[model samples]
Target chain A: MTDSLQRKRVVITGLSVVSPLGNNIADLIQQVFGGVSGIKLLDAPFVDQLDCKIAAQAQFNPADHFSKHTYSMLDRASQMALYTSIEAIKNAGLILDDAVKPRMGIYLGTGMGGANSLEEGYVRLYRDGASRLKPFTVLMSMNNAAASAIALEHQITGPNQTFSTACSSSAVAIGEAARLIRHGYADVMLAGGTEALLTYGSIKAWEALRTLAEEDVDDLGASCKPFSANRTGLVLGEGAAMLLLESFEHAEARGATIYAEIVGYGTANDSNHITQPSVNGQASTMQAALADAGLSPNDIQYINAHGTGTQLNDITETNAVKKVFNGHAYKLSMSSTKSMHGHLMGAAGALETIITTLAVNTNMLPPTINLIRPDTECDLDYVPNVSKTLPNLEYAMSNSFAFGGTGATLILKKVK
Target chain B: MTDHSVSSDKVLDIDEISKVLAQMIASKMELDIDTIKADSNLKELGLDSLDTFDLIFNAEDYFKIKVPNDQININTLQDVTALVHRLIVAQKQ
Candidate 1:
């Protein structure tokens, strides 16, 4: 309605990720291009306690990155977030001087915050009969811990917030951050998600939900097969991904290397079931994002799908895509990076968005690895098993649908 | 509140209370028990406000006596030990 609102543009300037594939963004993109699978059979003592023993665990050691005192205060999720934030900020080359520090903020998302710490604390208290739990247990387990920690670490005094929207958490976070910039609330934001819920408690809970993929074969890497006929369900994963978003003018003025412009963000709730996703909800969200971007469905070239490898999710998402894009759905390329990275839970959308941005920036579409035996009902070109290169890509969309029937979509465009 | 009364014969002495308090603070701070002095200020021992609150909680659980808000202004290990001894003595009576 206002002139200021109409003129402001949000763009992603820097991206970093701490994933199962790798820590740095370049290595992660490289691994994805190589059609690598990060999922592995977890060989921990706790694996024996769960129905599903495979997860895309990050190959990172927090001790190597943090001091004993600092590490002791952080949860695994917070550590991953902080690590990625540092990398993202450095990559953006934006020095948070006193003038900029107050305006810059953080928006992080996590489904289960500090689950490992909570599990460890409960085990110590109930099983070990310890009289006193750790002092920082509450701080470490809070859902906003990562956001608070990042804000404190960077001294970001503006709009520090966290979203806990299950699988759609990070997508909502990135969407909200973009809105903030578009509304002229802030100039820069560290937006993304982190998750480290690989503990016994978390795994057992997911097992109870019956959503974990059954690992029948020895090679657990093939466990997650999104949009495939043989796909069982999603394998759990732990990681973090962060994007440094700034106003387009701010980035251009600072001579920042723009990755891609985040043009549209849309979010909607199904209001139907707690776990089951609604096709209408998914379609409407995608439609809303396209409408927000002021672009027709035909203009989009690629889509990073939220294919969770679940029987219900893949089919529902495929139908939703068909509904939203209509004829163009068959033409444009779409794939689920979750096949390679597994489900990062709240961090899934952030990583997928990063991958989608890379696809738009480099014109190289990452494949949905292990998509053998495509589902009959789910008929879409999934860029199956191998990466593709298409130069001068125009528009790409990243979709994230969550457990509480929340759906979010982000439309990104190549900054040519 | 649940009954936290200790028998007069089972009441803990100041020395025992001091030792437990020191161990609790040391554990919370991740410091060696031998390094924490009874007269040294908790702030000097790297116990921030949150650490002090947790130490008070652990002290209450260990002694099975409720620590009043007034006693939370403890600056040294002696202060905590003295407060715990007073609370225990009062509970016994």
Candidate 2:
């Protein structure tokens, strides 16, 4: 906190997504806005063993984008992360020469890094009784594999770190990356999260926790219905999202197109329960973010809630919103894009933050689809079932409450 | 490790090992088999340390011989082939 370390404004210049709904930003916008649910019955060999057979799977093939020699050392999660980062850099029109590369860094998050690779290795060792495994297994299965791959590819020498706080992993990553820019630690950072834990092992573990949504009897796609009276639980998903964050001054100097300004970020631990959401923690986190932004609750127009379609989470989050926003919660529009994209675990916050930024930038709020029954306890204008245009939409928020009792809130302001 | 030895009569010579090594390198580097000379430097042929390790691992599986860690200083396909030939010959004894 010296003169050179004075607070600076950080703005998102580029965004890319490898989501269940779509791969590119254009397709993502179309699918999310059109209320398309990406959840479907899984196509894996072990799907028959699990009670919940559906998930929101990204339509991606690593072989299509990488060479055998290159992708052979990457996990499914790293593949999505590297691919998304490339698209984000291209979208930002960033020229990462040697000088800029040193100042650039990456901060990524993942809940289950390299799950597919690890599970495959386990099968080889245990099930197949294989005495030896490939050398690439360890490299591919590490938690920081995605971030390391991006840095090695781009020759970024700055602080490359990875966060793994379960569902709030990417939220913490994005917020911390913004903090670094605000405090002059780095000029630019590629911040985001990726998760590809829809493997057979991962699904079985989630099923053991009894948190996965049952497949809808009539339509598998509607398995996840956040804030609805008939909501079951969160549908597992696999995806990646990356945002290029830089100082506002730097963006202005380069004439970059700004998506939205990251005005505030707040994170808090519940210290109450390991897997249950806390109302006080969620409320205080939102209030802390509002205070950090130097704005009251009434100034925010939209919120992309961490609505995971679970009964407890929905009611707890609704009560948290009411506690923090007070009467303003009724006036502002809120929705859970997870109803369409399913719960992406570690990648959820970054994806929802992008959705929130888009809502603020385009003046169009995406809806929480499949919310047909309307749970009375969760009383709020959820922008249910369809997208809407909100004139003069200025600021929006995205909240991520993780299973480990961590709550993270990020506020985005429309770039004027 | 389990005995991965091939039949005693099928012991490969240096030339045969060189041919198989060339094919592995060619397939891995996506180059024509004719383009990968036995004497060409592996680095010059666009094979880094990781690529070299991968090629060696595949060669070990194919020839059923363990290329010792000390033999990892191979500079060319000929060198790799010679090392594999030695390992296979040792395995026969």
Candidate 3:
């Protein structure tokens, strides 16, 4: 768009995560690749009263990572985002010297920011009848808090933005960040999503919607059964994942290790309904991404689905894939890592994108765990509770379809 | 919250109040208690204006004394302690 300069290519140079599955890249890869489940019994005080007592909670201690005063000032969401961003910078071996600092930016996504702090403040006000609250309550509770915290910590002074599209928040965030690099708005970007909404009030609200999975009678961790006939609903989860993205030329000039090239990104919304996903919306978005990547339906070897383990989502997404890929839909491998990690809400897309990137780079397919009895309507490979190696895997797509009918698709190509 | 007695009836001398103030400042700033000299400027010790407000709030809760916004013109740990002590004495009277 600017001066018809050759469209730049965006590539992922580094990745970091703090999720229910694992905290670092190695552990995450091991867990996902081994088809290990991260879903566990809820560890909150109010779990006993709630019907849905399972969640995928990230195991993190802020005191171990942040200075006492610094951690006190941040919400849980900001803490995860800041930690992952720093780790991603180090992973990329990036030097934030003067020349690069000004051109760098931060883009983040979150469904709910500072849920803990907001809930605590409300409890103090209404329950305890306290007149005063914490000084940083507003700063921590704002939706842009995580992005601002990341920007402040790294002194990234360009194009800081935050996107909130419910569950698809991070996917949209990563997609827009790549667009920024591709269009020459910024040379480098830290893009990702974070969510920490596992509070009593948040869960009770979600439970009221009747869209949460009931705990399995036998195995508590097997509650979230995506694409299964007996699936109840989604299991709420919390975590954060950040990726260091740089223009191809910028990364190459620095001799950075490229994980994958972000060839295409597509985002669309269904104007028909707010909560129910539209097959037309998902199909069109995937088609748009393929066209942008200059690839055909047959070219995509894998899809990281936005399968939320709900009755509506799994069936709708299956139909959407069939509509887009047709017969090739049967050929391509598809899986929902949410089956194991639960639904990370905002961070799902970022984490799944990273997983897709790894699949392209390493030629391995992550599996959809806990799918005991696949629904006939949702018929697909789904990788089926077992990870497998796929030789010559070159291109993979990650999908995130959120509430409010927002759908995002990202196409990643192997660096080779 | 600071671990001081809740009731205003609990009396403390200037030295005890100063010790308590120094401990609170050190904990809030994540500094070593021994390094928190009474003569050191709080700003120089990395406690910003917002941090001062937070410290006052904690003191109010711990010492059971109200700190008026205008009455706070503290620079050193000693000033904070003397102010809190005076507020406690006023509350008692």
DockQ list for all candidates: 0.19, 0.46, 0.70
Error of 3 at A248 (Å): 0.5
Residue-by-residue lDDT tens digits, candidate 2, A152-217? 888899889999989999998999999888888888899999999998888989999888888888
Docking class of 2: acceptable
Order of quality (TM-score): 3, 2, 1
lDDT of 3 by residue, A1-416 (tens): 44436779999999999999899999999999999888889999888998888999999999989998888989999999999999999989999988898889998989998898999999989999988887788988999999998988988898999999999999999999999999888999999999999999999999998999988979888888999999999999999999999999999999999999999999999776878888999898898889878899999999999999999999989999999999999999999999889988889999999899888888999999898887999889999989999998999999999888888899999987
TM-score of 1: 0.89
In terms of DockQ, the best-performing candidate is 3
lDDT of each: 0.89, 0.90, 0.90
Worst 10 residues of 3 chain B by lDDT: B1-10
Question: What's the residue-level lDDT of A369 in candidate 1?
Answer: 86
Which residue runs does candidate 2 get wrong by more than 4 Å? A1-5, B1-9
Summarize candidate 2's per-residue lDDT along B35-93 as a digit string, tens digits: 98879899998998878888888887778777778779988888898888888888888
1 or 2, greater by DockQ: 2
Give the residue spans of candidate 3 off by over 4 A.
A1-5
Off by over 4 Å in 1: A1-4, A124-134, B1-40, B54-70, B77-93
Q: How is the predicted docking of candidate 3 categorized under the CAPRI scheme? A: medium
- Judging by lDDT, tell me the better candidate of 2 and 3: 3
TM-score for each model: 0.89, 0.96, 0.97
Winner on TM-score (1 vs 2): 2
Q: Native contacts recovered, in order, as a fraction for each? A: 0.13, 0.20, 0.60
